[model samples]
Target: MDPERFQKNAMYVETPEVFDAEKNFDDDGRIKRTGTLTTASAHIITAVIGSGVLSLAWAIAQLGWVAGPAVLLAFSFITYFTSTLLADCYRTPDPVHGKRNYTYSDAVESVLGGNKVKLCGLAQYINLVGVTIGYTITASISMVAVKKSDCFHKHGHQAKCSTSNNPYMILFACMQIVLCQIPNFSKLWWLSILAAVMSFAYSTIGLGLSIAKIAEGAPVRTTLTGVQVGVDVSASDKVWRTFQAIGNIAFAYAYSNVLIEIQDTLKSSPPENKVMKKSSLIGILTTTLFYVLCGCLGYAAFGNDAPGNFLTGFGFYEPFWLIDIANICIAVHLVGAYQVFCQPIFGFVEKWSKEKWSNSEFINAEHEVKLPLCGIYSVNFFRLVWRTAYVIVTAVLAMLFPFFNDFLGLIGSVSFWPLTVYFPIEMYIKQSNMKKFSFTWTWLKILIWVCLIVSLIAAAGSIQGLVQDLRKYKPFQAEQ
Candidate 1:
């Protein structure tokens, strides 16, 4: 599609009336703006950094020290560029255009065509749902870890609590139901800030603890070869593990799904592109530094034996308070991170509900929900019900498939290309109308091909590994 047509269709993608200055203003007539540079950074970081980073040691173990950092840095650059590309494509040529692309799916529809919207929507749902499930798993497992450490260190005995993580997952999913009640994306900035801080806190503690272990003469393994530190695996298994690591790394860097939404939160006069580029830089840089520390130090401390999760490898010798604090931070951050990514999904579903149930009692004249529970307050009935259901579904999935790192690897593989790489590059190429065989076009094509190959290999490897493991432990089997 041409750029002009893309601009016109944006009105159909996002509501035009809500952009009005008067409607967006407060009671005192002060203009209400959602975010600044800092909050944008926080939201982006919260979206980008989650339990995926915890698997970096396993990722590094897959690719080894040398290739691990190399691939990590490579994907980091690729994701950063794609993120900025999305930001650059976020607007229209004419100021008179009634709408801006406010979501990734909107951008996809704008640039590609209305026909591609469903395709984009599918990829988005898969990515968002997968990430949410990953978060639920991480949060529940983190809570369990915290409880275990508390029981062991404080009581001098292991906790006899149910080994299954399902209860904790349910509890935290209930907490998400309450948090998800905050209907506005504008209000989630504060939560994002807290989540960002929590993510950093846990990562920093993990790094420090790893360093302390190294200082205490803990055995350290150093190698550039692909090797399992603590576990024995066949060469074929190691090969699949290395491929899955690509997915893990890709997953760690997958935030393009929410990039446009984060950009929409910014209140800068210079347009969101400038702020988005800066925030993306800040968020990626901070997260990358933490990932390096956590991955390398965790590996240095535990060698080939580093657990899939950096914090999960901690033992009784480690400070109980620190472990408790770190795990708490992880759980809290995942809670907020879940919302950050899920907001766009919520928006999409709510819009669809409005179209499908135009005359339903659940909705009011202003498109708000008519529920008695939150009736006095403006709630989207579809949102309350659907978002809650989404959380529950993810929580159930987390309980069913508790393989944290493997699940993340599978998701990262499945969604990375379409969400992170393909849509961004294709949108840029189409929107810019870049000449084929030109320097930019040629390199973008090359990058797209590379992403396709990597995504296929990673997806295949992850699915194989998951299927093999699932055969050993059938669904719903309680943890021993």
Candidate 2:
């Protein structure tokens, strides 16, 4: 195929109209007014920092403290380099029109055309949905766990439970889907900012309380290796444990699509490439520092046996009032994440069924108004039903297999690795036409292979964990 024709075809590959405002350039080669750099960057950061940070210590504990930071840094380097390459491919000129524009799948199709691209695209979509669901379910459980703990229930009477069927979690997920349906990307940008701020604040406060507890001379346990204060797993299991750590790191760094979406959200000349590059750097650095601090402080304060959710775990030892406040904050923050995850899926479904259902007069016309200013929209009854079905499916899965962390790990291991590592380099080489791989490219390929291997190992471990939990699974139980 002629390179130009190939590029044009790739450019038009599944480019959704909803995203056109952000991705389409005007006569002057600038994106139409959609959102600002700050707004776009905030969304990127929010998308990246989900439940993975909370569980860093658990994974790192298996690898020991000395190895934890090193692993994190390595993952960060790999993620940043590969992400940059993908960004470069995205900026390549369109083959047909001689214009430079790209979509997430465009990059993939450029390298591995035909069935490979389709398979990868399908996997990417599934992974995105899976992670979103994973985050939603985990966040819901965390919210309810916090609420029922001594923290949120200080008053004798519980807040009237919103929805009884699947607990308030279903209700929470529904609310998020509704919010995401709002059509205004700009408005959604502000919401993303709020969510990102709340996440950082909640995590910071929780970490602070844990640190204060440690400073007050709380009981501290040294590692089995006799390290005064650090993570330690048995030496015999070091390699396997390191593999686990790599999986955790990959999970933490697996938001490249989110970053790409954010980049596409910008409305500037050539979309201000620096904005994304800088934002990603800031996001990764902030996230890594936060995780390391939280992990170290949490371990110092409560040791390895600390509650899986550090906030709830710390609440058991702190003042009842502090715990209550923390619970409320955590719940709110989690709700925000649920909203972010649900929005894209809602958009995808809405677009998928638009032709059949959107023009039907019987359908509520008010639902079709693309309210870009507010980033909110109404969905027809069918869309609502579809979303509800998704919620039900996810909730049933969560209930059937209530091993939260392991389930999350499994989702992360299976989906995140292919989406993040395997696909990016392939896209880059094919799209950019790098006939001879540079040293940097060669290193990245090696790193991606390593990540792929680690993902498989982690998937196996997570499956094992899930099986063990299922053998002893029980319905929701309040933390003792």
Tens digits of lDDT, candidate 2, 289-351: 787887666656666554556654443434556655655665566566555555555555555
Top-scoring candidate (TM-score):
1
Please provide, for model 1 over 1-480, each residue's C-alpha lDDT reduced to its tens digit, 9 standing for 90 to 100: 233332222211122333444545432233345588999999989998896676687678767889988888988899898988888767643212325677888888878877678887888888887778888887888888876776677566554543567889999999999888776687788899999999988888888887888899966665786575345467788888888878778888888888888877777465668888999999999988888877877777777766777675443235887888989999999999999988888878776766887676664232433445443234455556777888888888888778754666787788888888888888888877889999999999999999999999998888988888777766665543
Q: Best-fitting candidate, measured by lDDT?
A: 1
lDDT at position 258, candidate 1: 87
Q: Model 2 TM-score?
A: 0.79
- Residue 11 CA error for candidate 1 (Å)? 18
Please list the Cα RMSD from the true structure of every candidate, rounded to 1 decimal place: 5.9, 6.9
